[model samples]
Target: MPKIIRDLEKKIFNTSMELFLENGYEGVDMKMIAKKCSIAVGTLYNYYPNKKELYIAILNESWNDTFKRFDKLKTLQLTPREKVEKAILMLYEDIEKRRGLGKELLNKNIKDLIEDARVSEFKKALIKNMEMSISCLEKKEAYKDDNSINIRLAEILLVSIPILIESHRHEKEENIRFLNEMLDGFIL
Candidate 1:
């Protein structure tokens, strides 16, 4: 897309997230997003096609930003356990900042939308990041030598940690304590 269109999409996405958080998905409409973004409704449709598409775009953007953060964590020289801990903390901090919007977004049934090609690449990147983290943990002997358990644990943590953070947004201290205890069981 052209720079202008890309910029507009971002604006629309951010505006939609805020509106959805404040009012909820069913309460917000295309016109509301356009008004908040200071764009024509037609212009918004030019990029998104529909409200569901717009919502999915927001989710994809959020997921991509998160994956970028995880990518950055890999550059640090920390141990496998430390990498996982840091990644979890980063996710927690981010979710805490956007907890309301995130809760609203997560309330949507996005199973089919997330499987779309537009967002699938980010999903793959997330899986790759998890696999890399698990590999590092295995190398450091944080996990048993059994490949199956390592794979399962990696998949579980990759999917669960984010959901856990989002679910426990109101109980952050307790959630962090539980999360750290879970991590401690695997770390040496």
Candidate 2:
């Protein structure tokens, strides 16, 4: 029989996230994580295999949490545009809460691993959610159905918001106002 460590994976994930957030990818290693978790290095490897894998796992979990929040918003009585606007704010809040981990994760050294990790699935999901919001608007009076336009809006928001966050962290209100204006042309 194999030895079991209760909540080992959760502990590992939490510890790894804390260390990575505090020290960055280069500053944290499997050994450090293992030591913090009071596990042998090999045991940690049994769970995560490598640092990149562990980092990707953390990225996936964080995005999943964000998506969960998105789902909760669906039950509200807000309009489609309101949903998208609120979701955009949630995305900004999520990135801001990460405390520079987003920038560190985008470092060139780890960009390849991010692709390999299928992190784009989160982007696709966000776009799909946005598309759903746009499609819902078509059912409302005076809104037209334009599949191509809806998709483009979704893709543009998916691509641009993070860039805005990274580039203009200090001017969030200005960025949101500009985005809302742009989105108004398409979404409203």
Candidate 3:
């Protein structure tokens, strides 16, 4: 009789995500992931042909999860300011859950990971989401010298700020305060 493993794929996915975030792309391999997953190396290979393919799967799953949560926020009848604030707060909580692993991973962009088409689309989707969310702000004039929304500033705000925050060692409260101080200038 063939054995059935309940949620084996999910177990692999979660374990691989943690390992990748902790050790980064270059530092992790299928055998290591197999050990962590409590499965045979052959079994791991059967599920994913290579590390890059597994990494791409993990990336797609994780990104889709974030986007799904944020999509809920987007549907709420909230002001743009409220939407952005809530979104960042939720992201901050996600960062807190990743206390040990996520920050260091941000600095190392694996070449193979970046070269993947899905990763490229992920980057584009991120920027487009920021643009649309910022465009929702009612105080468009507040963002500009000439009363037009300065999208470049919004881009910097959305993309660079979180990376900057994660790069430093700071307490959660301090990070929140710092983010609020930075965002207050634009929202006014």
Candidate 4:
């Protein structure tokens, strides 16, 4: 039964992902997902309550692969600062690599609905990433006393990078250089 459930979930995910990519979030609905999966609306709702939940499930699955790469960064033997610089570059490159999905994340149409628990889970994962990345720097220096500061800094880096990318869209290398230069100020 568990196998059947997992298979059904995978089917739903695959169908919803294709539909979501072809149509924006608003363009797809629970009914459409159910139809695409050839399942009843109740069955779809049993797995995912609404369109937002469906979208979040799809996003969570997609991010699982990226999170693996993020995990691997921690195993590298570079200095704290170098790890951060690489993370910054990795973040930038990941955004570029998944530009379509990234755009959906910041898409205006779904902005209002993105403030849900599932979205919060995604945000928390990112914050944890930031904290891990920053903890390396904190260990080098004794100034890691404040938790809020680290949180804000993480928030800033994540939010600002996408905006920075937009303005420096023509020059990706310049963006990396600018981010690395900024990161240098954080190191002792």
CA lDDT scores, all candidates in order: 0.67, 0.75, 0.68, 0.74
Cα lDDT of candidate 3 equals 0.68
- Candidate 3: count the clashes: 0
Off by over 4 Å in 4: 1-24, 30-49, 100-115, 138-146
lDDT of 1 at 94: 66
- lDDT, model 1: 0.67
Q: Can you write out model 3's per-residue Cα lDDT over 1-188, one digit (the tens) per residue?
A: 64566898888888988897788777899999999988888888888999888887876666676678777888999978788777666666654555433332244466676666777787667656655666665443545554445465455655545564567556656666676567666666
Q: Model 2, which residues run further than 4 Å from truth? A: 1-11, 19-40, 100-118, 138-146
Worst 10 residues of 1 by lDDT: 99-108
Q: What does the lDDT come to for candidate 2? A: 0.75
For residues 26-96, write the lDDT of model 1, one tens digit per residue: 67889988888877888888888887677666766666677788888899999887887776677667656
Top candidate by TM-score:
3
Report the Cα RMSD per candidate: 5.1, 4.7, 3.6, 5.2
Q: Which pairs of residues collide in candidate 1?
A: none
TM per candidate? 0.68, 0.70, 0.76, 0.68
Better of 1 and 4 by TM-score: 4
* Alpha carbon lDDT at 31, candidate 2: 92
Between prediction 3 and prediction 4, which has the larger TM-score?
3
> Which of candidates 1 and 3 reaches a greater TM-score?
3
